[model samples]
Target chain A: MPLRTLLQADDVRRAITRMAHELVEHDPDADRLLLLGIPTRGAVLARRLAAEVARIAGREVPVGVLDVTLYRDDLGTQPTRATGRTDVPADVDGATVVLVDDVLFSGRTVRAALDAVTALGRPAVVRLAVLVDRGHRELPIRPDSVGRNLPSAKSERVRVLLTETDGRDEVTIE
Target chain B: MSDHLLSTRDLSRDAAVALLDVAEDMADTQRRTVKKLPTLRGTTVVNLFFEDSTRTRISFEAAAKRLSADVITFSAKGSSVSKGESLQDTAQTLQAMGADGIVIRHQASGAAAVLATSGWTRAAVVNAGDGTHEHPTQALLDAFTIRKRRFGAGSRGRDLAGLDVVIVGDVLHSRVARSNVWLLTTLGATVRLVAPPTLLPTHIESWPVEAGTDLDAAIADGPDVVMMLRVQRERMTEAFFPSAREYAALYGLSAARADRLRADALVMHPGPMNRGLEIAGSVADSPRSTVLEQVENGIAVRMAVLYDVLAGERTA
Candidate 1:
């Protein structure tokens, strides 16, 4: 049950800023872009990313929360957790959707999120963005925008704490 | 979490509250353009009814479908059950066909309990309504509606502490009343059961509720919710009440009785109502009536129940 701080508050801020710049560079059209955060910390990270995007592009990007709990494939296999709210602000039809998450591990979460997003509406393109990519991906999915690529053992758990929910901004390993 | 929702008595305070909170999330899903969830996509849910029902059956069906589960509806009439096939045989057949969940409504009390405890089926058993024993889902939805009406969006993680609820009409044959009395009380609501002597159950003293024969007296208490149970005329082969007109005069939620209620007091009905028999048409359709809300919440509540029983971790 030991906890060690992996990324400090300043590191998270800098990583987000860099990711925002990369997103702007990759896609100049901010109007057709929508950032949907996976629930829990993913949602908080999405809001932060949206703010960062607004700061860089000077245009507000629509952000929504996508709960992948119900869309998960391993529902009954692993004890199913309660589902969070899925709120998509705009019609996703023909829009580039960047699925945001705090951590990227097995890629199963992103896969579930993709299913959830597609069920909402047919997007022109769907992209993946993560604050941290900790490898050990069981699925063939990769993040387009990654804040950090911290390789670690599969036995270890990466915990991302945000000020919105956890009252602190830091990444930890336990 | 239990694997089956057979009775409200099996629900702990925390479990009951958790189910309600999950239902709130389900309700939130209803507002979205894509109301379907992928949670139960590969899962199969069978609506197994050994009795006739419209609302409860449809509510469970809608709930299962919304969760993206394949739903197969089985009615007793025109089915193998009408050919004198037993409940165990039918349940085993469903199990063999790979049903992950069974939402059952039966004419006999304790049928759901038997299906849940017996090893005939491995699927999670959700009692839509089992005779007059209990309709746990109905009570859950009723509680959800009441909590939503009283607390609005702040109802999450909240219990009905210090709330007053009065259940009226044919208590002798009402699974809704039995379930509500147990669940509402468990959620910290003080319940008062009002029915005529003939309509009230003989063993009412054992129930965890204040029992009374005077509807006016109970209404005078200004309860937070007034739930009217349907008067099953078909069930009453012998005269339970002297006449429908006399019952309406004494116990029916007339417009006058509705006016006597506090402005905040909500009216409820487990429907297929005998309009003028147990409740007045005006009162049933009144602004305070959560009748329609109950029907709507029924889907969300059943979804929560199905989720908790089938997908949730078995903690107990």
Candidate 2:
């Protein structure tokens, strides 16, 4: 299969900057804002977005990692996955929590993340931010902020590569 | 990652390390206030024991409960096994009740192996301990405890390589010793079995371990870990040693013996200890002892094993 580049390094950077500004604008309370990244590529994207948020809002937001492997619904039917570290930095109660991920596909991951976050503590509100939104949501979930809305077929694979993990910054569909 | 964990002899180095790494994750989850996970929510686990056990049963129960699996415990003393029901009948009855996993501790050796391979039930079989055959989870917990103490946070994806381990006393009827011998050796640790001639198993020369009769000589060598095996009085149909006092004097980890050990050397004991017979009370309570840590790690290791058998694809 041929691979198609959806967003290059510059495009990725520009999109992240825009998303960061949008997050700051939506929730002006920077003190109550928390950014939690899903594992692997999503975690790197989260850190990058945190840096951009600090640059735009002139204040640092707490960032942590939340892995939803254990909360997955298809645990027994499929192979068991290794759990990543879940480091909740601040008190989640009464906070504006943003779950950041690299790609938004079936939304099962986001569903698990919702449960994982709720299990930690009750947040005032929970929103989602994604770098790429490939629309094939199995759950009734939508991203609050999206970098690029790439409509694609079900058979294709969407992969996001970041400089922190893959030594590059791009989004590809193959 | 086998379908059934009957013995550590079937576990490769990679398989053992993978399980340990997963146990590390489980241990991390235990540090949280909300320690329960919904991974095995709808599955049912049965604890079938033809032998009596306190810590092993509770550890397995806690492990299954933490993962949100329903547990049913069956003991031979009060169960239908006392009414002349055979093993097959009991196993089939549990299978009919929709048991997804069975953790069994039996008095007969190879009982778990038979349950796993006899086509009686489709559920995964985990050997709690079968007679003197093996207790894979206990060894895995011991390995986890050792790795955690030695490497701390850097313990993930590592084996017990180059660690010198000395196992003392009652090897003939110790499933813990048998399991640890295979697992520790497979993980690249050199193990020495120290016991009286009668307590050592027959044909010990064929096992992948160094054997000795003198505990003082083994301790003087300054091993990285000194594990004490409990002297099971109930299992002693024949006198394995001359007397309890002589046994304590020679093989017991007294305060003096513990003091002679290197400061960094770890002291380990599988539970239900005869306090003054196999290990001194002071030594068992000292900072060097990992007996409590072993019990704590047992829950995590059993959780990892249950997850490995019931949820994960077989990697063995």
Q: Which parts of model 2 are misplaced by more than 4 Å?
A: B313-316
In model 2 chain A, the worst 10-residue window by lDDT is A76-85
DockQ class, candidate 1? acceptable
Index of the highest-TM-score prediction? 2
TM-score of chain B of 1: 0.98
The candidate 1 chain B region of ten consecutive residues with least summed lDDT is B307-316
TM-scores for all candidates: the values are 0.93, 0.96
Deviation (Å) of A144 in candidate 2: 1.8
In the range A12-129, model 2's lDDT, one tens digit per residue, is 9999999998999888864799999999877888888899999988988899998888888877555667667787788988889999999999999999999888877789999999
Question: DockQ for each candidate?
Answer: 0.48, 0.54
Query: Which tens-of-lDDT digit does each residue in A52-151 have in candidate 1?
Result: 9999999899999998887777777666587676777888999989999999999999999888888777998898889999999999998999999999
Question: Candidate 1: where are CA atoms >4 Å away?
Answer: A1-4, A94-96, B312-316
User: On a 0 to 1 TM-score scale, where does candidate 1 land against the true structure?
Assistant: 0.93
